[model samples]
Target: MKIRCSTFLNCHLLLFRLYFLSLLVFTFATTPEEDPSVIVSRFQKYLQINTAQPHPNYYEAADFILSQANSLSLHSQTLEFVEGKPTLLLKWPGSNPNLPSILLNSHTDVVPSEPHKWAHPPFDAHLDPNGDIYARGSQDMKCVGMQYLEAIRRLKASGFQPIRTVYLSFVPDEEIGGHDGAEKFADSDIFNKMNVGIVVDEGLASPNENYRVFYAERCPWWLVIKATGAPGHGAKLYDNTAMENLLKSIESVRRFRAAQFDLVKAGLKAEGEVTSVNMVFLKAGTPSPTGFVMNLQPSEAEAGFDIRVPPTADQESLEKRIAEEWAPASRNMTFTFKQKVSVHDKFGKPILTAADSSNPWWTLLEGAVKKANGKLGKPEIFPASTDARYFRKRGLPAIGFSPMANTPILLHDHNEFLNQAEYLKGIDMYESIIKAYASYVEHTRDGASREEL
Candidate 1:
């Protein structure tokens, strides 16, 4: 039956209302609910799998990470460089394609640990009385990995897709310089595809109340020096022998080391000093193979050093200094200097983040930490290093961060464990940071920058 004009207008409004209700239902059906706890629990479960270096059961971890990505309806891929080490990449679509993307990186592989030495089995995700989860990878990385996943999961669940794409990378071998992991990933075209405006990687722990944020990392330069001289009888003078030359070289290096030590001791060097030179290995003459040839001069001697230099220092300066001061002409000791081929090939250029770099991203982080009842501590660069360096080297504005507040950190050492309060606080810290950053993208980019991203 034909309706009157007044009634027709009312009917039209009813139809519109029905359509809006249907749309809401469709949206809710497609979007998952955001559960921060769910994310953390997922991470805890992930930690149960062993992912140690050399043979981290990477296949198992990769499958798990990929499965979660698939469940989230996100695109995931496993990049393989080494035979057994697999890197997993997961991407979430953004509403706007024009905005710059953000890359969240984490390494799944950890260093070998002796479970017998730990209070709990390193692989077992054992929770203590205070709710602190104890595990080998807990402090070093597994925690951070969960933070990344949880953040993205919440964003997706809330139907709050980012304006810029967010790429999650769980790579392998970062503990050992990322040979088949982050390093190779950086060189690949996959990274080039990411119009990454800002990156967030792992950071070191600060034992003191202050938080340590890393802007740059010292590049590692591993050097091996060998000396060869005359081998003679036990009663010989042994002048100009391999032992003498090696000792001289060692003394020269030690002198430089002493200066650095003094600087550190005197408070002249901050946490992230300009350089740190450590002698890791030294072997000269046969100890037992020759069976007590005390008086004879050995023909071969070797010394190895792990040298770290500030980003400002170039290869030329390092080499020149080693030649002049480390093995000077006056020493009259001929030596062979050998560096790891991989070290020289890729990391020859120091990876650095200038103090004055124009990264407004830092401001966002500062706000997040503050909101979580944490003040922005001194922005100290990392003395050691992290996967952040790889992203920084690729010219992405990367920040290495950890959110455990006012807690003792014992990463890579004996009796390492995060306090129960600190672990829970980290969840809050990550939630705040992710919300802030995600909202920032939404407001800045309005679905127009897909090509740029």
Candidate 2:
């Protein structure tokens, strides 16, 4: 009887031990740390990190990206061309490192959002029942950054080896301007050493089933025109008053702006193909305790214009018009022209990437998209500037692409969101794209074959 009781107790103890051990294993496996392996979870984690300007939390973003790089076993480095702003670079070395590398670039910084305007908190990264992930940067670009990582993760898991090196660059300050980020990095020694063949960057979402790609982008030219003339009482009408001269210039700009807009409205030109100019600011007043001294006209009036010029446009002709008509010296107006970016490469060639069969990279990209069960729209010029312009200025071929089809273009807009299904599909698309780009080897080049195992 004693032995029977002892044996029963032992059995119970053993079973309890085994059950507890199993519970422990399950708990650890299902922990939050393990959740990142799930793509949507990982994306939400990235979106939760507030990297919005002004005042981006670059350090935290860098750490998160570095953790991902470590998980993938890729070599990662954080470079700061400017203090307080970091550029994260991750390299997945190919079997044949001698071949030119492929660069995947994404900006980490996003434009600031008003939380009150969003259905969910902009930083919350909420997923509605409709499967839309709502957050700032959901469409503007953070989606592309994570898609690049998830695609690489899938490729690595499949034990795929590349014939050419692959690099991912997460840069900052693109929302304001890339001066502290991509612009500096593109001109850095590290980029020069990479021997990059082609670059892939962010593109706009399409409202249709076909994904859009950009071969070139418009250059931004910020213009400030000031008019100086005799000051007088607001009620007194005088010839060549500060406001009068400024109004003439503004009228001239309005006419030119209308002509450019008419082309788009008439379907004669796409928005990207025309020169777009809009007045961003106007200043001419005498300050008072209330708001302004409405009784008096100021001696000087100023207006700032944001202008986007296509590479195909003649820049000299535009500048000449600005001097002779828009802010002519004869009209008592002076102007300051700030070309935010150059439209030409160092060799004076237009900063453009060929989208046709003439460019093997484009062919590879097109076929890869098709293989992924995706359709690409006709290549067009990006209506605004992007970091691709920096790469293109270096005479490197760069493509602006984002695989978001059947989605509204809500970048930098209120209630920006990306559908979970669409985001997942983008990962698959990028997987095909990365695989195709990394495996391609030019037969004409010496030693272009894959390295021996």
State which candidate has the highest TM-score: 2
lDDT of each: 0.71, 0.90
Q: Of the candidates shown, which would achieve the greatest lDDT relative to the real structure?
A: 2
Q: After superposition, how far is residue 110 of candidate 1 from its true place, in Å?
A: 0.6
Off by over 4 Å in 1: 1-40, 287-292, 329-350, 354-357, 441-453
Write candidate 1's Cα lDDT for 403-450 as tens digits. 666656767765456654565566667667766765565334344322
Distance from true location, Cα of 180 in model 1, Å: 0.8
Q: Worst 10-residue stretch by lDDT in candidate 2? A: 444-453
Alpha-carbon TM-score of each model against the true structure? 0.83, 0.89
- For all the candidates, what are their Cα RMSDs to the real structure? 5.4, 9.5
Model 1: clashing residue pairs?
96-447, 97-449, 97-450, 98-448, 98-449, 98-450, 234-295
The regions of model 2 sitting more than 4 angstroms off are 1-37, 443-453
